[model samples]
Target: MELKGIHHVSAITANAAGNFEFYTKTLGMRLIKKTVNQDDVSVYHLFYGDDIGTPGTELTFFELPRAARTHEGNNSISEISLRTASDAALEYWKKRFQEENVEHGEIEIRYNRKALPFRDFEGQRLVLISEENENGESGTPWKKSPVPAEFSILGLGPVYLTVPDLEPTHKVLTDLLGFRREGSYLSKNYGQSEIVVYASGKGGPGTEIHLEERKDLQRERLGRGGVHHVAFRTADQAELQEWIKKIENTNFINSGLVDRYYFKSLYFREPNGILFELATDGPGFTADEDLSQLGESLALPPFLEQRRSEIEGKLKPLETKVKEQ
Candidate 1:
């Protein structure tokens, strides 16, 4: 079963409004959707990405305002990467961060890729990598943000995962899924060798998956400030079902077809203890809301319509506004 690429990456954040400001104003991604978490209506499930909020372009967050800070450890996702047009775009980002007084680390090279690492308002580590090998769907420009037409984000870059042992995780990524070993490196921070995996073709945004081996580091707890799950894309429902069978046959428990409103999802955890999802690509976020008013209001799945008023009252109000640097 061949996988197309990443569908979306979800994480937990501390403040919804702060995250909104950072992602939309600081990072220049469009606030594509503002909704509530299906399971927990008290929290906001905010999504930020390219215009039109394409499937693979989404970076979602669950806001838990009072949650405690989580320590970054071996069993957690280390960083989220976004791909830009070139190294020159990264330079532009550096200048933008400086102008905003947001402290960013120096640009670094890993696994032969150039990346600039920075943090959001909630301390979620994010990287901007300049790689143009993979083709991206063209979308409308986010006119409100500082991002210009040419250098806007292509989409999500490699989702970084860490584990205690590298072999089992590597096997799941290469054998079960179709990612190939791109390169390996010794981390200056963790001081252990990390292997980076990329899709079969020359990888770009949402293609590379980084795995770090840290035997001594403790396992991480999933809560605020942690990645929820990493989803890989499939061409359609048939392909998704095929991979579902493939994953179930491998002795992993996979959730059967789940209607995510826009896309269908099948979820399973890999051998390395990382949660992975296989998602379909059609029936997107615009299925209900018109493209013009997509992220401006609370959008819910059809089944939840009867409870809309209660859900809306439970969630905190989040207003989207452009902030000056």
Candidate 2:
């Protein structure tokens, strides 16, 4: 019962409309699903991914209109990495960011790969990594993306987590979650501490997590621009059930076998307090909408269909129209 790569990383955004614009128009990813957070029907939970909203490619956000800016520190999902075609793609993004007035760092190598770190308008940390020699699952870019298909953002790469200490989190990853220790890399910023790497099934950038140990920082105060949780992919309900039993065996408090409609999930926090989710890959975004019409309108799951009127009345209308190329 090995877990696949990342399923999705859910983050917080204060402006649903602005977040929608940045992710779809700026990043050129397809808005695969337009829905509200299941736990809180009043706010939007938007999902962006490749053409068909493939499991590992999804990057989601939960909108909280009045959320405070994130106070960054340790014990957080520090940075998110998006994969692109090659080092030339990094060049394209660097030039694009400059032209768009997007804040970004110069392209540099990190962990033997070219990367360009940048922040969204909300100050959400993100990096684009060149997938020149990377392995694991390849991403399917949206053909109609504003950026050319060859240079478009493909999928999630290695997720970075910063914690005060590493031992506890390391144990949870290597022992409890079945991730293999893939060695460590020296951090250019954090003093003396080496960033450790862990890989799940098919071990590659797509399935890896880069963990940074930082004793110099405080616990993160999460709000807008902060990552809510990162989910790993499981094959189906049966494997998810196995993971549920496995997690239940441990002392970690977990939400067992949650039917997310699009996917089944189990949520828990690692030792460092970073939320982790194990999600199934089946019954995907296509369950409710046609491929061509995804994200064109708000979608609700069966149970929530009855409350659609109440939910729609609360959320501010978000324009999901895409400009024709």
Candidate 3:
């Protein structure tokens, strides 16, 4: 089966209130879901995206009130890139970052695409890449977003993961996951070894995954502001099930079939141990809530209905409004 693109990338944050304000007010993404982690109901699982939380545009977080700071190292998702509508849009973000005094890197070129590396308040590594994609379309902007729709973020671009060795992960990507090896690029950003890129599906801006070699770095210490897993998109349930069947028979381990309420998911790990998930595209953010009322209230899956009151009472109220100190 053909993978469409990235489904969603999940990460962690120690501060729920801070994370909610950063992504919504500072970044202008719409909070499409307000729910608790199904496995751990005391903490929150927040979903942010374009107007209605489109699949490709999703960036989710699990609020960990006291998780340690994430240690940057090999075998972890290093950076996540988001698609910018145009070079003009990139400039808008630069000015906004400066005005807000947000920590950001200077604009640089990688793989012929212009990118600005930046970090959230929690120091989650992120980048905005400005490239010309004629086939790409910007997602619907939040009605109350400060950034205009023309300059709104389109969706997820390529994701970067640092691995100790390339050959093993490369084999899993190309041979097993059906990714096509594109060319490699070298820059001072990485060291002597060049970063290899593997393209999935039709391979547009949001369909690329870059693997960087960083053997000297230490193993990632899982905690707040670190990516939990990267998910690739399957068109629907049938294709997702096909992947589950393929993974179960392989040397790689898998989570089998899972019902995530919004989508069907099968989780597994690449050889390097960076968590990977295959998620379907159907029954999306609108499954339970309507477009107009999206993210207004807490949403619970069927299994968690009985404990809604308990969960809601435990979760801190996540206010999107930015309060001046």
Candidate 1 lDDT over 86-169, as tens digits, reads 788888888888888776788888666678888766677788887744364433556665788677876788888888888888
* Alpha carbon lDDT at 129, candidate 1: 86
Candidate 1 lDDT: 0.78
TM-score of 3: 0.96
Candidate 3 lDDT over residue span 80-149, tens digit each: 9988877778888999999999999888787888888899998899999986643654567777776787
Instruction: Give the true-structure RMSD of model 1.
Output: 2.4
The clash count of every prediction, one per candidate, is 0, 0, 0
Q: What is the TM-score of each candidate against the true structure?
A: 0.92, 0.98, 0.96
Alpha-carbon runs more than 4 Å astray in model 3: 320-325
What lDDT score goes with residue 288 in model 3? 89
- What is the per-residue lDDT of model 2 for residues 150-268, given as tens digits with 9 covering 90 to 100? 99988999999999989999999889888999888887766757999999998888899999989899899999999999999999999999999999999999998888899999999
